[model samples]
Target: MESKIILITGATNGIGKAAAKELAKQGHTVIVHGRNKDKTLRVLEEIKAETGNANIDILLGDLFLLSDVKKMADDVKKKYQKLDVLINNAGGTMGKVREATDEGFEKTIVLNLLSPFLLTQSLLPLLSNAPSARIINVSSEMHKFGGKPFFHDFQLEKNYDSVRAYGLSKLYLIWISRHLSAELKPKNITVNTVHPGVSNTNFGLDADRGFFTNLVGKLLMRFSLTAEQGAASLIYLASSDDVEHVTGLYYGPKKKPAEPSDRYYSIENENRVWGYCSQIVAPYMDT
Candidate 1:
């Protein structure tokens, strides 16, 4: 396989880190995104030493803030002319208490959905420059059980639970992925989402989602997949030839196509979500 330039968010730890190392081992130029500069550089060095591939780089940005996301995208455009694969792998659950960023948007939605949407839009030019680009979004199976689409209340201003917020964000991410796949097909960019399975990462462990929820999360971790195991599907989507032309499909940990729940799906709702995200990130689009 030919070399490609790949950027993965939240690559400082967990599944993102695992995926970055594997991709670098495959001789790709891997750009790892992280919020903490020190930790990110440390992980970059670790991956280089372990993979014996020095083509790895790092970019820093907070995914919870759209302005930061835009700046990060600008940094990428300034440094690299083309991007082959972009993995939107940076996302997490919040605490039980509902919180908003300094930009005044809900935390979960911004991190998991809106920021990735904006970042992808901002980097479209770079992605289009590649021969055949891929956009891999890391969604979750929780979208099936935990998502409760209150279309009128996307930000969950009224009823907000951490798990529900995460589920809705992942669900909406799938919707936008499908929407973008069609929009970017002519540009040679294939967009898809994946469920990494229940990984034994620090995913929901730090979140204070109340005593009961936390306990259940811990119990489930005992039987969860390893970070590398969880990242298998992501690695496949990023580099495999089997899915080179596949777009707008959801893949499971088995590295095969899987159906995403469409219980709350409709053309109207999908368009609404897209429009809502575009409006929220409009100010950052040009800058």
Candidate 2:
């Protein structure tokens, strides 16, 4: 494989970190994102030492804030002339109650959806500079469990549940992937989403949880896939030749094209959600 400039969001831990190591091992320039300056640097150095690839770099941002996402994008644009691939992998679940970021957007929606939307839109020019660019979104199979999004209330303001919020966010991400795939077709940019399976990573441990819930989550982590294993599908979608031309699709276990829930297939919902996201991120995105 040829060396490429790849940026992965939320790469300080779990599947994102694992994917960064694997890609760097392949001799690609891997730019990883983390929320903390120190942790990001540590992960960056670790990947470099492990892969013997000094090209590894880091970017820090709190995905929940659109401003941070834009700043990160601007930094990338100024530093890299071309971005061969972008992996929107930074996301997590919130607690039982609703939590809003300082920006007023729900934490789950902003981190899992809006951040990627704004980042990708802002960096389209850099992606377009490459011969063929790929956008791999990290979604979840659990999306089916999180009932369809309340299109009217996209924020879950009326009734909020942790599982529901997480599922809706993932589902909406897949929908956005499909919608954007069409939008970028003329540019030869492939956009696809993947389910990393259930990984035994510190995924939701950071969220506030009750004693029982926390215990259950810890015990359940033992039975899931290792972080490296969970990143397999992500690696496939990000660099595989078989999927070079494939877009607007979801890949799950076995790295096969899987169908999302029926709710994600609704054209009406897709258009509405796409327009809504565009409007929300317009101020942060370039004209």
Candidate 3:
């Protein structure tokens, strides 16, 4: 419960917001992140007021934009010499259609997988400076197994489904995280992924399909999990002293190890994914 610096994304609401509040309550210098400036400020204020911990700061940006990601992480680096924890929790289904991001890539995969990989790489200096640090990525059990990301037509130009795209993004995240855990082993920076049980929160609702998702689907998702229930695995990985040295593993609620679906555990398959992502993000990887 030391006053360590921890930066978390998607903190305006839902699981990410819950994590910011819990970490602040525990006395960490929580840096809350969200794209909406007003909502981000509100969340920070609530956390500070509830925890009486004004050490919280806010960093705002769209996770899909690499420039925005760099800017946010760089801004944090300028202010803090050490980053005790990083929760890569910003994510969602980027709609059913395959929309290209500003960076000219599939939106869902880029936001959920590529953005975290890039952001974490960019923040390594700060993370490594801390005596002990952890990177807890919000991965999902859905990553257990699937066909390799279409290496040639990677963004599914042929056929695109929102649910499947989101799941594929999470699957890539686990592989990236597992690879990073190994790469950072010498540096004592534990890299782990968490399956924050499907807690009800706003993820899929948007303009294209607002009425159906917001009125019906969102209620069901919310019913699945109170934010507190969803944030459990994240909190465990972020704050627990028991799993301090645990790395390259998947965690579920109650701090239990998650048995990935049969398809996801293939080291060979994961390695294939690691190579692909690393190549794509190589230009941004300085360290």
Candidate 4:
């Protein structure tokens, strides 16, 4: 495989960082993305030292802002002519209450779904230009258990809960991925989503659950995959020649199919979610 240009969001920690390290080890040019400058720099230095791969570059932007997402896409496009892989690996859950961005959209939705949607949209031309490109969305199992988000209350304006909202965002991501799979079929770009499995990331920053979360982490996640293990499927999809032309599919622990909640299997839902995403990011979409 030729040296591929890869963009991975939320690379400071967890699955994102793990994917970055592994991908770099494989000799791919990795664009490491993070919101925090200090953390990104530290991780970048470590990656370079560990992998001896200097091709890694850092892209920083607050994903909650569509303008930042657009600017980040522009920044990435400027640095690389061809984008062979786009991994939407950033995610977070807003605890307990509803939160909105400066633009009045829900925080979780903006970060997890809208940012990826717009970033992928803006980078389409570059990705399509590559002979073989892939878009890997990092999704979660919560989406299967999480309830459907209403079309009318798309942003959860009337009602809200942090975990539920996060799941809905993942659902939208899966939906969007499937739709892009169909739309980009004729292009060189491929799109698919992945489940990283219950990871021990710092996403659970809430100190209130320190006791229980720690216990759960020790019991359940300790034996489970580390960030590197969780990121295996993503690295496979990104650099492995095995999945050439693979697109619009959902993967679980071992690239196996995890029956998505019935709703996610519907093309109707995918179309509707895509419509909603386009409507949400219309103002900031790159022309």
Best by lDDT: 1
lDDT of 4 at 89: 93
Task: Give the per-residue Cα lDDT of candidate 3 at 114.
Answer: 80
Give lDDT tens digits, candidate 4, residues 105-215: 898889889999999999988998899889999888889655866778878988676667878988888888888898988986788899988776666565233465446
- Over the full model, what C-alpha lDDT does candidate 3 score relative to the true structure? 0.82
TM-scores of the candidates are 0.98, 0.96, 0.92, 0.93
Q: Give each prediction's root-mean-square deviation over alpha carbons.
A: 0.9, 1.3, 2.3, 2.1
Q: Write the per-residue lDDT of candidate 2 for residues 157-187, one digit (tens) a residue.
A: 8868888888888988998899999999999
Residue-level lDDT tens digits of model 3 in 82-189: 898999999977665578876877888888988898889889999999998999999876665335456555566775666667778888788779889999999999
Q: What is the lDDT of residue 125 in candidate 1?
A: 93
Once fitted onto the true fold, the runs of candidate 4 whose alpha carbons sit more than 4 angstroms away are 207-220
Q: Give the better candidate number (3 or 4) by TM-score.
A: 4
- Residue pairs in collision within model 3: 144-264, 200-221, 200-222
Q: Rank the candidates by TM-score, best first.
A: 1, 2, 4, 3
| Better TM-score candidate (1, 3) | 1
Give me candidate 4's TM-score against the actual structure: 0.93
lDDT of candidates 1 onward, in order: 0.94, 0.90, 0.82, 0.84
Of 1 and 2, the candidate ahead on lDDT is 1
Residue 117, candidate 3: how far off, in angstroms?
A: 0.2
Give the per-residue Cα lDDT of candidate 2 at 216. Answer: 81
What's the distance in Å from true for residue 103, model 4?
1.6
Lowest summed lDDT across 10 adjacent residues in model 4 is found at 206-215
